[model samples]
Target: MYSFTGNGNPTLVGQLSLAAGGIGLNVSQDGKYVCVGGVASANLYVYSINYINTTATQALSNSIVFGNSALGSNYDLNVRGLSGAQIEIDGLVNYDNVN
Candidate 1:
């Protein structure tokens, strides 16, 4: 839960926890829309941006890792759309519409 306001350094805003065995992360274009998914399970997390670093900002968005609980060693973690790329599944288009 850290953020940087364009010029200044990063700061902690909040803290979130994943329910173990989480998998996917989808970020929208405007630093918003952070979605975390659970591995082989049915769960998702949505977060909002507090701040971002100008140089090393990726860590602010990529820190969403798998949790510890029923994780069982099978967490297929993956991140997508943080760069505003569109995803398609079975000819269906998916977009990060986070604001």
Candidate 2:
């Protein structure tokens, strides 16, 4: 994702590797999750939004950002072995087969 600064200039912020180039990607209505539907792989990926608050002394004072924090272990359900499940190389999403 590319986020714009206060000046409205875009900057490279983050990325996710999916099973295939996703044609359908969206953030949840509640703004707490990101969803991607993969047609080629027949998969669904749900990612919890991670926001970090920076204090005044930090570079991005009083800002929220996608930090490099790991999701809780259960966030990625693939390891529990959903039947015939496939996980992306990045393992950044909760996996499920939409098909």
Q: Please, what is the TM-score per model?
A: 0.29, 0.40
The Cα local distance difference test for each model comes to 0.47, 0.49
Cα deviation at 1, candidate 1, in Å, is 19
Clashes of each: 6, 0
**Residue 3 local lDDT, model 1:** 54
Candidate 1 vs. true structure, TM-score: 0.29
Clash pairs (backbone) in predicted model 1: 3-51, 4-51, 4-52, 21-39, 22-38, 23-37
Off by over 4 Å in 2: 1-22, 62-64, 67-99
Candidate 1, 91: how far from true, in Å?
38
Tell me the alpha-carbon RMSD of every candidate.
Answer: 13.8, 12.0
lDDT of 1 by residue, 4-97 (tens): 5898786654444555564566555455446566767776566553332335643343332322223343433333454565765442222222
> What is the lDDT, from 0 to 100, of the residue 26 in candidate 1?
52
Cα TM-score of candidate 2: 0.40
Give candidate 2's whole-model lDDT.
Answer: 0.49
Q: After superposition, how far is residue 8 of candidate 2 from its true place, in Å?
A: 41
